[model samples]
Target chain A: MKARVHIMLKTGVLDPQGEAVRHALGSLGFDGVNAVRQGKVIELDLADGTDEATVNEMCERLLANTVIESYKVEIL
Target chain B: MKARVHIMLKTGVLDPQGEAVRHALGSLGFDGVNAVRQGKVIELDLADGTDEATVNEMCERLLANTVIESYKVEIL
Candidate 1:
């Protein structure tokens, strides 16, 4: 089974990296890029039947910093 | 328009960050994790009609290191 965790900073948190990318794009002549947000995706190959709850637990315990970030788990 | 670029290290490339996460998960008692791969997701709020080709250009020129990383762009 494969599971993916998408971790993103919570709205209202400052994202300097995203801002940097937006700035760089402007320098490269791409304009009107209103907003940019960067996040992390972790792909996991887990034992079959691992379940979504287990993946959620992993995110809460290790994959995300709940204080300033949020995560979504997808199982496939 | 919204665009999402998912950038991942090419297969056969070493991903130390993913390995570190796997090790940490094991130390925390999560087992049977066959593999872990870490990647980046960049979300952009672009002008309407920005088009997919523009996003691909962004990936090739700036957003991704094409030599070692592959990226998928999704327009939504």
Candidate 2:
């Protein structure tokens, strides 16, 4: 089984890296980029029969900082 | 308009960060994790009429390093 995780900073949290990318884009002549938020994606190759609950646990315990981030998991 | 970009390291490239997370998972006693690959996602809030082409150009020019990574763009 394969699991895909999308981890993103919560709304209202500051994202300096995203801001830097937005700035860089403007400097490169790409206009009208109003905002940018950077996040991460983790692709996991799991053993078969690994259920969604286990994936979620992995996220809560180590993959995401729940205080400032939120994550979505998909099984494929 | 909003655009989402997913940037991932090319297959066959070494990813120390992913490896580290896999190790940590094992240490914490979560088994059956065969492999892990880490990537990034960037969400861009753009002005109306910002098309997919523009987003792809951004990726090509700044958002991703073509030599080592590939990116996907989705307009929403």
Candidate 3:
């Protein structure tokens, strides 16, 4: 089984790295780039029968920083 | 308008960060974690009417390291 996790900063949080990317894009002549927010994706190969609850617990415990980030999990 | 870019290391590329995460998970007692891969997502707020071609150009030039990474662009 494969599980994919997407972790993103919550709205209203300041993302300095994202801001830097935005600035870099502007300097590179990529106009119309108003804002940028950066996040992470984790792909996991899991043993069979690992349920969604277990995966959710993984996110809660390790894959994501829930205080300032939101995460979504997709199992395939 | 919004564009989401997912940048991932090309297959066969060495990913030390991903290996570190996998090792961390093992030490944390998360069994059945066989393999792990990590990537980045960049969300961009763009001016209205920014077309897909322009966004692809952004990825090709600035948003992704084409030498070792492959990127996908999603416009919304």
Answer with 2 or 3, whichever has the higher DockQ.
2
Per-residue lDDT over A1-76 for candidate 2, one digit per residue giving the tens place of the 0 to 100 score: 9999999999999999999999999999999999999999999999999999999999999999999999999998
Between candidates 1 and 3, the one scoring higher on DockQ is 1
lDDT of 3 by residue, B1-76 (tens): 9989999999999999889888988888889989999999999999999999988998898888999999999987
Candidate 1 yields a Cα-based lDDT of 0.96
Q: What local lDDT does model 3 show for residue A6? A: 93
What is the lDDT, from 0 to 100, of the residue A17 in candidate 3?
92
True contacts kept of each: 0.92, 0.94, 0.90
Candidate with top lDDT is 2
The per-prediction i-RMS, to one decimal, reads: 0.4, 0.5, 0.8
What is candidate 2's lDDT per residue for B1-76, written digit by digit as tens? 9999999999999999999999999999999999999999999999999999999999999999999999999887
DockQ metric, candidate 3: 0.87
Better model by lDDT: candidate 1 vs candidate 3:
1
lDDT accuracy of residue A70 in candidate 3 = 97
Which parts of model 2 are misplaced by more than 4 Å?
none
Chain B alone, candidate 3, TM-score of 0.96
Cα deviation of A72, candidate 3, in Å: 0.7
Quote each prediction's TM-score: 0.99, 0.98, 0.96
